[model samples]
Target: MKTPLLQFTDNGIYCKKANVYLDPWKPVDHAIISHGHADHSRYGHKKYITHHRNVPIIQHRLGEINVTGKEWGETFDVNNVKFSLHPAGHILGSSQIRVEYKGEGKTSILFGYSLGKAQRLLKYLNTDIGEIYTHGAIENMTEVLRPLVDFPKTTLITRETKKEQLLGNIVLAPPSAHGSTWIRKMVPYVTASASGWMTFRGARRRRAIDKGFVLSDHCDWGGLLESIEATGADKIICTHGYTDIFSKYLREQGYDARTEATQYGEEETEAALASKSTASV
Candidate 1:
C-alpha cells in the first residue's frame, strides 16, 4: 500500500512528504498549527506556522518562540507538498490547514471561552443581526482583542443600563451568568446558546435555552459527513470526539475509516480552569 500523504503519529498528524506535523502535542521540528487553542497549539516546537492573526495569541500564550505567520489561502511548499491556511471561522485567528500532495486536499469548538469564541461572535454579528450587548467579562476580553480583530460595536452591560434597553438586543455572556442574579435584568430575554453540543437532541432543553443555534467552532455530524463526501477521500481517520462510533459508521458506509488516539479535548477543561482562576482573582 502507498504511504498516505498524512499519517497519524505519536507527535500528531504528520506529513512525511513535508517533514512537518499538524497541531502536534509532542515537540517536533516543525508544526503547522490550525488554531491557537491550547489543545491544538502547544509550546516546544523549533518552528511554528499558523494564520497571521494568531501570531499575537500564541506568542502571548507560549512566550518567545520562532514562528511564521501565513495569510489565508496563501500556498507555500515544503519538500514536495503544498500547504495553505484557510479561515476556519472558529476564532479570529483560527484556520483550517489544507495540505496538498499529488493533487489531493484535506480539510479539518465553542463560544463558551471568552477569548476565541466571544470574539468570533462579535466579529460575525452586526447591528443588522441584532444590537450586540456583552457581559463585562466578554467585553473586557473583546477589548484586548480589538487591536487584532475588527469587531462589531458592542455595549457592555452596566447597572445604569435599563432592562428596556436590552429588550430586543443580543446579549453575549458566559454560561456562569445564565442562572445568576446578574442575569435577572434580562428576565424577559429568550435564552440561546451557540455551541456544537446544541446539535444533540434536547441539548437546548437540558441547558434551559429557549433557542439553540447550532453554531459551533467544530463541525457537527452532518457537517462531518458533508466534508468527508466533498473530500472524496478513500481513507478517513478520526482523531477525536466520538471517534470509534463515527469511524464505524463510516466503515459501514463502505469508506476506509479508522480512529487514531490523540491528545485533544482538554482545551475546554483548561479554559474552564483558567476562567475559575481569573474569577478568583
Candidate 2:
C-alpha cells in the first residue's frame, strides 16, 4: 500500500509530505487552520496559516500567536506538496484548505449569527437578491469587518424605520431573535434557519421555522459526496459525523473509506454556547 498524502493523526489531519497539520487540536509545530472557530483554530500551535481575513479573528481569540495569512487560491509549497485556501462560504473568514502533492482534486444566505454567519451572508448576498436589513447586533459586527470585507449595503433596523421599509427585504438577525418579541415587529414574516441540522427531517418544524435553508458551515450529505467525487480519490476518510455509517456506505460503493477519531466538536456544543450568548443580547 502507498503512503497516503494525508493521514489522520491523534491531533488532526496530518500531511506527511509537508510535516504540517491541518486544524490540529493539540499543539504542533505548524498548523494550517480552516477557520477561526475555537474547535478548528485552536491555540498552542507554534505557527499558523489561514485566510488573510481570518488573521485578526484568530489573533483576537488566541492572543499573540505567530501566524501567516494567505489569499484565496494562492498556492504555497510545503516540502513537495502544494496547498491553497479557498472560500468555504461558511463565515466571514472561513475557508476550505486544498492540498495537492502530485495532482488532484477540486472543490448562501439569510438570517444568521452576527459574527461569522452574518458576515458570510452579507459578503455573498446582494441587493440583487433582496434589499438587506440587519439588526443592531449584526450591523455592529459588520461595521468592525468593513475594512477587511466588501459587503452589500445593509440598513440597520430602528424605531424610526417603517415596517413598509422592511417589506420585500431580507433581514439578518441572531438566532436568539427567532422566536423573540424583536422579530414579531416583522409581522407576516416567514421564519427560516440556516443550519447543518436542517438536513434532518422535520428540523424546520421542530424549530418552528417556516422554511429551512439547509445552509451550514459544515458539509451536508450531498456536499460530502460531491466533494469526495470531485477529489478523484479512491480513499475516503471520515473524522466525524456519522463516520461509521457514512464510511460504510462509501465502502459499499467500492471506495476505500474509513473513519478516524478526532477531538473536534461537531458544532452542537459551540452552537449551544453561541445561542446562549446571542440570547442574552
Candidate 3:
C-alpha cells in the first residue's frame, strides 16, 4: 500500500512529505494556506505560502507573520516536495494548493469568512452561463474594494449601457434587484443565481430563477463527485459541510475517505451592497 501522504491530526492535515500542515488549526513552522478565509488562513503559523494577490487581505487580517505569496501557477519547493497554488475561485487570491512528492500528489481548496464573495460569484458567469451585468450596488462596492482586492471583470448596468446590451447577459446584482423595476427595463433576459442552495430543483423553483448554477464557493454533491473523479486521488478527506455523509459516500464508492474536524465553514455576504437601488423601469 502507498504510504499516506497527508494525515489528519489535532492540529490539522499534515503533509509528511513537505513537513508542513495544510490549513493547520494550530501554529506550526510552515503552513501552506489555501485562502485568506479566517478558518482556513488562521494566525500563528511561523511561515505561510499563499497566492500573491491574497497577501494584503491575509496580512490585514493576520497581522505580522512570515507569509510568502506566490503567483497562481508558480511552484515552490519545500523539503523535496513541490507545491503550487491555484485560484479557488473564491476571491482575488483565494487558492487551492497542489502538492507533488515522490510520485504522489494531492490538493486542498479553502473557502470561508472573507470578502470578494461577489467577485467569486462572477468567475462562474460567462456566455455559457450568460453575459455579465451587475447591480449598481455590487458594481459600486466593487469599485470601492477593487483597489484592495482583484474582483472579476464586470460591467455596471448603467443608463449608458443600452438595454439591448443586457439581452444576452447575466446580471450579478443583489437579491433585491430580482423582480424590481430596474430589471423590468432589461426585458427578454432571464434571471438566475449561483449557490449551493440551488442544487435542488425545488430550491431553484422557489428562487424563481430561470436558471440556477451550482456555483458555490463550497462544493455541491455533483462538484464533490466531479472533483474526486478529476483528481483521481486514492485517499479523500472531507473537511467542510456534510462531512460525515460525504465521507461515508466516498467510502462506499471505494475511496479512502474520512472526516476531519475544522471550524471553517460558510461565511457572510455583503448586506451593505443591497442598500443601493438602480434605475426604475
Best by TM-score: 1
Q: Give candidate 1 misplaced runs (Cα > 4 Å).
A: 1-113, 128-130, 159-162, 222-240, 250-281
Which residue pairs in model 2 clash with each other? none
Kindly list the per-residue Cα lDDT of model 3 for residues 159-221, writing each as its tens digit.
Answer: 677776655345666655666676667665556666666666597688677666665666668
108-161 per-residue lDDT for model 2 (tens digits): 114576677778877876454247877777777788899898888887777677
- When superposed on Cα atoms, how far off is each prediction in RMSD? 20.9, 20.7, 19.7
Candidate 3 — what's its lDDT? Answer: 0.70
Could you tell which candidate, 1 or 3, scores higher by lDDT? 1
What C-alpha lDDT, on a 0 to 100 scale, does residue 223 get in candidate 2?
Answer: 84
Error of 3 at 207 (Å): 1.4
The alpha-carbon lDDT assigned to residue 210 of candidate 3 equals 68
Instruction: Order candidates by TM-score, high to low.
Output: 1, 2, 3
What TM-score does candidate 1 reach?
0.45
lDDT of each: 0.77, 0.78, 0.70
Ranked by lDDT, the better of candidates 2 and 3 is 2
TM-score for candidate 3, residues paired by index: 0.38
